[model samples]
Target: MMLSHYLIVSGILFSIGFLGVLLRKNTLVVLMSLELMLNAVNLLFVAFSRYNLSLDGSIFVFFSITVAAAEVAVGLAIVVALFRLKQTVFVDAFNEMKN
Candidate 1:
């Protein structure tokens, strides 16, 4: 596969994730969308690494994956806590943070 092919796929994935984040009302779906976007970036990093025959991009991807995993963990924890508090996972339902 060519670099352009990888880039095109990454762009499509990013666009889908962006749309999901903007249009989805559910917190869990939004989080998943965010993860999708992160993965798209990771794909780009790996692709460039391969194209350039370098290890730096791959190293960056490793860190990106680590950070993404941490993000998912924290995001899910927040979502679960919010659900327990309000019994709902809709983004709009979280407009007010005060008791």
Candidate 2:
């Protein structure tokens, strides 16, 4: 309800997501972490907007959701391609991008 509460929740979620992204070797887990971070940011935006009684934060959140949807589409496609090529989903196996 309050902005501080939302911020604290978002901070915790972001930290957890960051840890997941750092510790997980699986591509899927990494992507899920990314989603977690995005959702945390969205929550912060919405809470700030409500606190300020303005619509801009909500508008930005809307755009962020749109962008996140597009990212999911492209990210999943790329992951699928990686799986087909590497026969694995481990992030450490992603050597194709190396020079």
Candidate 2, residues 1-99, lDDT tens digits: the string is: 556888999999999999999999999989999999999999999889999999999999989999999999999999999899989999988986597
TM-score of each: 0.94, 0.94
lDDT of each: 0.96, 0.92
Instruction: Give the best candidate by lDDT.
Output: 1
Model 2 lDDT, residue 81, Cα: 93
Q: What's the count of clashing pairs in each model shown?
A: 0, 0
- How high is the lDDT of residue 28 in model 1? 94
